[model samples]
Target: MKHPLSQFNYCPLCGSAHFEAHNEKSNRCTECGFIYYFNPSSATVAFILNERHELLVCRRAKEPAKGTLDLPGGFIDMGETAEEGVAREVLEETGLIVEEAVYQFTLPNIYVYSGFPVHTLDMFFLCKVANTDSFKAMDDVAESFFLPLNEICLEAFGLDSVREGVKRFLKR
Candidate 1:
């Protein structure tokens, strides 16, 4: 497949057709001297382990991997820290409130939304959910459930980063 920025033929700032690849990750407009950088976006994922040691996972409701197992998280919004963003995603996907969490790890991932592959920096967090009672699937999740850490099927996770992160999460 071609690079994701290949579609960006015109300069976004000046709407000039003189834009061309300036570097591996940026485009520069010769006419307007504008450079557009295709930087990786920030995303977050939560690893909420219940008292029984079952990790809370969700079935994706949207495309790119519908019905696949995923952690409760999403892209970090503007003005939110990774911790804040992760808690918001967990709340949106699983209806759980994260009281505390620690940044565990990070993984680079490709998130294909609307058929466009966007590079992302996925931040994984070890979260403490208040309780599992409010765990109702919503938002981007079609269903919410817990899987025993040992019995988790890594293949069920659709995202490569999630699969890798879960491996590290399970090991430690």
Candidate 2:
């Protein structure tokens, strides 16, 4: 049997099979002493609300939670600040430009892709859109709509992190 780290057999820089786990979260090349660390990716999701306090939600168009309700956000881009990344993602998914975002909280999540678990730090925000009329389902979103906070069904969210975020938001 092979350890999961064996999946990354060779050092990316030197192509040497001497690359082995230095720790649970990293690999080191014995030949060149180059180390590679497995780092969690940062992602963002927004809770967009109108004056009426109805929250905007989207249905994911892809797996691991296809067709399930999700917030209007995605992975933060490199070199982008969390606020900027979140706004961009919200705009891309829901077509609503975020005028402002208030950082709410963060959650650790495991996003499984192709049988490998990708860890993520998911940042949540309470956002105000520049315009509600701009709302539309776009990008990886199958549908977009609003639901009152009192009427929100957490079970409709496929991701546990998102569900927990919503639960916290409702309490706030």
Candidate 3:
């Protein structure tokens, strides 16, 4: 697993080639005395449940976990709150509008993107939707559907944090 900071060879501020690893999570430019710290990006995961207690899930359409079962969510964009990000992701991927998103917990994860490790803090939420009637798989989701809580198979989820989060949710 490659560290996210290892991908950068030059300083972003000074554009100097003297940028070197300063610590486990940062780099320093010897020429400009500028230091950049690599922090975990904020992400969200939705645990949407219908009246029957069936959990909404999606099949990933992209790599890093393509073709695997996943929750409807993604990285939080700039200028967006975690709740806003999760709701937006749900609508984008599953066509479901989240009316309520109650924060449940958080988990640390390393999402590999392109080829670099992207450290993320995944916020989990117990979300509510008006109905599943408008559901359609879109964006990064290849397919979307609901599964009975008892029938959810942890192994089907390819992402480590998602599988662990599902396990935690199941225990609740």
Model 1, 105-165: lDDT tens digits are 8999999888789999999999998987678998988998988988999999998999999
Clashing pairs in 2: none
Model 3's number of clashes is 0
Runs in model 3 lying further than 4 Å from the true structure: none
Candidate 2 residue lDDT tens string, 100-167? 99999999988777877777899999888888866889899999988998899999999989999999
**What lDDT tens digits, residue by residue, belong to model 3 across residues 127-168?**
988887779999999999989999999999999999999999
How much does each candidate deviate from the true structure in C-alpha RMSD? Answer: 1.0, 2.1, 1.0
Candidate 3 lDDT (Cα, 0 to 1): 0.94
Native RMSD of candidate 3 (Å): 1.0
Q: Candidate 1 or 2, higher TM-score? A: 1
Error of 2 at 15 (Å): 1.7
Candidate 2 lowest-lDDT run of ten: 1-10
Give me the overall lDDT of model 2.
0.88
Candidate 3 weakest ten by summed lDDT: 1-10
TM-scores vs. true structure, each candidate: 0.96, 0.93, 0.96
